[model samples]
Target: MAEQVKLFGVWGSPFVRRVEIALKMKGVEYEFIEEDLTNKSPLLLKYNPVHKKIPVLLHNGKPICESVVIIEYIDETWKGTPILPADPYDRAMARFWAKFIDEKCLPALWKACWSKDEEQEKAMEEACELLKTLEAQLKGNKFFGGDNIGLVDIVANFIGFWVEVLLEATGSTDLLTDEKFPMLCKWKHAYVNCPVIKENLPPKEKLLAFFRARQQPTSGPKYE
Candidate 1:
C-alpha cells in the first residue's frame, strides 16, 4: 500500500515552509492542509496537542510535530535527495546550527522587529551578533551544506526570508542588509532561489501584507 502523507500548516509560517521545502527536496508527495491558526482544526489539536501548532506532519497515520523534527523525519523516511549531511559530525553540526537558528537567531530577530525601546535595541544587537557568527560559519561556502542546501540551510529559512519580510512590514530597523552581512545576504538569495524553495515559498507581497496585519495592536506581532 502507498504511504499517506498530510501536512497541517499556515500560509505565512517560515516553520511550515521549511517542512514543505524538505518534502520537495526529497520528492515526497503530501497534502497541504492550510490552517487558520486562530481557530485551529480538531485534527491539528489531535496530532499536536502538546503545542497545538501547525506544521504537523501526519505520515501513514503517525503524526510528527515541530518543524525541525518533521524535516528530520522527512529526510529519514524518504530516499530521494539528501537533506542532512552524510558524515556523523557534519550531521551533528547541521543539527546544532538548526537549533541555534531557532533558539537564538530567530528569537533575537523577532524581538528586534517587534519590541521597542531598550529591549528592541538589545535584541537588534544580539541578532546582529548571532548573524555575524553565522557569517563566519559560512566560511565563504556557497551554501551551509556546501554546494547544495542541507539541514542547516533549510532550517535557517526564517533568516533567509521571514526576517526581511517582517522588518519591511513593520517598517523597522534593518539588520539583514547587504552592508551588514554580505555573505548571509548572498546565501539568502541562493537559498530562496533554489527551485524547490522558490516554488514553495509564499508570495512575498502576500506575506508582507499578512505580517502588516499582525502588527495591529489588537492582533499583536505574534503568529498564531
Candidate 2:
C-alpha cells in the first residue's frame, strides 16, 4: 500500500513554505492541514511532541518533525528531482550554507526589523554583514546551488521574499537596497520570480498586512 502523506503548516511561515516547496518539486501528493499556531491542533501536538510546531510530515501514520528534516525525508522518499547535490563535498557545502542561513542570517534579519531605535540600527549592521557573507557565496550562480533551486535556496526564502515585505511594513526601505547588496538583490529578484517559487509564495499584500499587524503596539504576542 502507498503511504499516506500529510503536512501541518501555517500560511506565512517560511519554515512551512520550505517543506511545501520541496514536496511540490518532488511531485509528492500530501494533505495540507493549516495550523493556527496560537491554538495548535491536537494532531499537531500529537505528531510533533517535542517542538509542538507546524511543518510536521506524517507518512503512513508515522510523524517527522522539523522543516529541514522533512525536506530531506521528502527528497529521499520521493526520488524525483534532487534538492541536495550528489557530490559529497558540494553536499556538505549546501548543508553548511543552509545551516548558516538558519542560524546566522535569519536571527540577524529578524532583529534588524523587530528591534527598536538604537538596537534596530545595531541589528541592521549585523544583518548587513551576515547578508554580505551570503552574497559572497552567490558570486557565480543564479542561486545558492547554481541554476536550480535547492535546499539552501528553499531555506533562504526570508532573504529572497520576506525581508522585502518586512522592510516595507516596517518602513525601512533602506535596509535592503540594490546598491548596498547588489548580488543579493539580483538573487532575490531571481528567486522571487522563479516560476515554482513565485507560484508557491503567499501574496505580497497579505504578507504585508500580516507583518504590519505584528509590528503594531497592541498586536499581542507572536505564536510562530
Candidate 3:
C-alpha cells in the first residue's frame, strides 16, 4: 500500500500556497485539509506544537511543518520535477536568495500591511529597496535560479501576489511601478502568468474583499 499524504492549510495563506505549489510541481497526490485558524484542530496542534501554524504536511503519518522546509522535503522526496538545482554552486545561490526573501523581504512586507500612515510609508520604502535589489538580481535571468522556475522562484513569487494586493488595499502604487522597478514589474507579469502559478492563485476579488474586511474596525453597541 502507498503512503498517505495529507496537507493542513488555510486558503488565504501564502505559506500554505507555497506547499501547494511544491506539491503541484512534483505531481504528488495528497489530500488537502483546510483549517480555520480561528478554531484550530487538535491534529494541527499535534503536528505543529511549536508554531501552531497551518500548512503541515503529513506523509505516511510523519509530519513536516514550515513552508520552506516542506518544499525542500517535497523536492527531495519526489523525483519527477526538480525544484532545486543538483549543482552545488547553483543550489547555494538558490538557497541564498530564498533565505534573503524569507528573512528580509517578507517581514518588511508584513510590517507595511499592519502599520500606521508614517510607519507604513517607511515600511514601503524598505520594501522598495528589497524589490530593487531583486530587480537588479533578475536583470539577466528568467527566474531567480535562472532560465527555469525553482525554489527561489516559489518563495519570491509570494511577494508578487501580496505586493499588488497590499498596494490596492493600502492605496499605494510605488512598489512595482514601471518607472521605479521595471524588472520587478516584468517579473511579476511572467511569474503570475506561468501556467502552474496562474492556475493555483486565489481569486483577486475575494482576496481584496478579505483584506478590506480585515481593515475594517470592529464595532460594539453604543450605550447612551
Per-model lDDT: 0.87, 0.84, 0.80
Clash pairs detected, candidate 2: none
On residues 8-58, what C-alpha lDDT tens digit does candidate 1 reach at each position?
Answer: 998888889989999988888899999987788999999999999878999
What is the lDDT, from 0 to 100, of the residue 114 in candidate 1?
Answer: 83
TM-score of 3: 0.91
Worst lDDT run of 10 residues, candidate 2, spans 215-224
**Candidate 3: tens digits of C-alpha lDDT, residues 50-77:** 9888789999999999888999999999
- Per-prediction TM-score, please? 0.94, 0.94, 0.91
Question: Model 2: per-residue lDDT, tens digit, 19-98?
Answer: 98998899888899999887899999999888898789999999999888888888888888899998999989988999
Is candidate 2 or 3 superior in TM-score? 2
For model 1, what is the alpha-carbon lDDT of residue 149?
92
Better lDDT candidate (1, 3):
1
